[model samples]
Target: MAMTMRKMAVVAVMLVLAMAAQEASAAGGCNAGQLSVCAVAITSGSPPSAECCSNLRAQQGCLCQYAKDPNYGRYISSPYARQTVASCGIPVPKC
Candidate 1:
C-alpha cells in the first residue's frame, strides 16, 4: 500500500509539471500576423514596425528556435533583423 501511494504521488507530480508546461506554451506571444509581418520585414530588409517589435518582445523566448532553424536561421540572423530587434530595445533570449 505504501509503495502504491508513492507511485501515485510521483505520477501526480509529473502530471502537474506537464500541465504547467503546456499552459506556459499556450501563453500569448507570437501570433500568426506577427510572424508574417516579421518574416516580410526580415526578407525585405525593411525596418520592423512597432507592432512587430511588440510581438517580438512578447515572443522573445520563441525567437531562439527561429535562430536555430536552418530555413529560418538565415533570415533571423540577418543584419536587418538584428538591427530591428536592437532598435526595438527588446532583449534577446539566452536560449
Candidate 2:
C-alpha cells in the first residue's frame, strides 16, 4: 500500500507539471511565473519593480488569458495592474 501511494503521488506530480508546462507554452512564449513578480504591486498598490516590468513586457502575449482567469482575472485587470504595466513602459494590450 505504501509503495502504491508513493507511485500515485509521483504520477500526480508529473501530471501537474505537464499541465503547467502546457499552460505556459499555450501563451506563446509566456511563462506564467514571470507575472508573479508583479503580484505584490497588483494586489497592494505598490510600485512594480524593474523585474516586474520586464516580466510584464515579456508576458504581454499572455495578458488576454490572464484577464479571463477566474481566480486571477481581477488582479490582472485591476487598475493597479494596468498602472504597473504602464509604469514599466509597456503598453497594456487591449484584449
Candidate 3:
C-alpha cells in the first residue's frame, strides 16, 4: 500500500510538471491576457499606441490561438482587430 502511494505521488508530480511545460509552450510563450493593452485599439478601430503595438507584436505568434478561443475569438477575428494588428506592422494571422 505504501509503495502504491509513493508511485501515485510520483505520477501526480510528473503530470503537474508536464502541464506546466505545456502551458509555457502554448501560444508561443505569450499569455493573451497581456494583450489587454491593445483592447481599445482593437475594439474602437483607432490606431494602436506604441505600447499596444509592442504588446501586439510580442504576441504575434499567439494570434491564431487567440482567434480559436470562443471567448476571445470574436475580438481577435474581427475586422477591427485585423486592422489593429496591421496598424502595428504585424501581419494579421489567417486564423
Candidate 4:
C-alpha cells in the first residue's frame, strides 16, 4: 500500500511538471497580458501606437496562440485589428 501511494505521488509530481513545461512553451515567449499594448488599437478605429507595434513584434511567435484563444481570437480577427497590424508593418498571422 505504501509503495502504491509513493508511485501515485511520483506520478502526480510528474504530471504537474509536464503541465508547467507545456504552459511555458505554449506561451512562446509572450506571457499573459504581454499584448495589452494593442488593446486600444484593437478595440478602436485609431491607428496603432508605437508601443503597440513593439509589443506586437515581441509577441510575434505567440500570434498563433493568441488567435486560438477564445477571448482574444475575436479581436485578433477583427478588421480593425488587422488594419492596425498592417499599419504597424506587421503581417497578420495566418493562424
Candidate 5:
C-alpha cells in the first residue's frame, strides 16, 4: 500500500509539471507561421505591424530559437527587432 501511494504521488507530480510546461508554452505567443511572417518582416527592415507584435508576444518562447539561428538571428538580434519587442511590451527573453 505504501509503495502504491508513492507511485501515485509521483504520477500526480509529473502530471502537474507537464501541465505547467504546456501553459508556459501556450502563453509565449505565436504559432510557427506567425513567427515566420514576423521574422520575414524584420529581415526586410520594415517596422513590425500590430499583428506582428501580437504574434511576437504570443510566441515569445520560440523567439529565442529564431534569434539563435544563423539565417534569422541577424534580424532577430538587430536593434530594430529589440526595439519592436520592447515597444510591444513583451519581455525580451534571454536565449
Candidate 6:
C-alpha cells in the first residue's frame, strides 16, 4: 500500500508538471506573473510606473488572454485596470 501511494504521488506530480508545461506553451510567450507590478495600479487606480508600463507593453498580446482568465479577469477587466493601462499609454484590450 505504501509503494502504491508513492507511485500515485509520482504520477500526480508528473501530471501536474505536464499540465504546467501545456499551459506555458499555450500562453504564447505571455506570463501573467510579469504583470504583478501593475497590481497596485490596477486595484487602487494609481498611475502605473515605468516598469508596469514596460511589462504591460511587453504583454500586450496577452491582455485578452488575461482578461479571459477567471483568476485575473476581474482585475484585467476592471475600470481601474483600464485607467491604469491608459495612464501607461497602453490600450485596454477589447477582450
lDDT of 3 by residue, 1-95 (tens): 97686556435434433443355476358566666666666656778899989878887887787678665567778788899888888887876
Q: Which stretches of candidate 2 lie over 4 Å from their true place?
A: 1-22, 25-28
Query: What stretches of model 1 exceed 4 Å from their correct place?
Result: 1-33, 92-95
TM-score each candidate.
Answer: 0.55, 0.67, 0.69, 0.66, 0.54, 0.71
> Between candidates 1 and 2, which one is better according to lDDT?
2
lDDT of each: 0.58, 0.69, 0.69, 0.65, 0.60, 0.71
Model 4 clashing-pair count: 0
Residue 4 lDDT in candidate 5: 80
Task: Judging by lDDT against the true structure, name the best candidate.
Answer: 6
Error of 6 at 40 (Å): 0.8
lDDT of 4 by residue, 1-95 (tens): 97686556435434433443366576456543555556556655478789878877877777776667664566667787788789889888887
Best by TM-score, which number?
6
User: Which parts of model 5 have CA positions greater than 4 angstroms off?
Assistant: 1-32, 36-47
Off by over 4 Å in 6: 1-28
- For candidate 5, the C-alpha RMSD (Å) to the true structure equals 16.3
TM-score head-to-head 1 vs 3, winner: 3
Clashing pairs in 6: none
The pairs that clash in candidate 5 are 28-58, 28-59, 29-58, 29-59, 30-58, 30-59
Q: RMSD for each model, in Å, please?
A: 16.5, 9.7, 14.2, 14.4, 16.3, 11.2
Candidate 5 residue 78 Cα shift, in angstroms, is: 0.6
- The residue pairs found clashing in candidate 1 are none
Judge candidate 3 against the unseen true structure and give its global Cα lDDT, from 0 to 1: 0.69
lDDT of 2 by residue, 1-95 (tens): 97686556435434433454467776567565667666667655679998888878877888887678664566678888788888888888798
C-alpha lDDT (0 to 100) for residue 12 of candidate 4: 46
Where model 4 places Cα greater than 4 Å from the true spot, the runs are 1-28
Candidate number that wins on lDDT, 2 or 6: 6
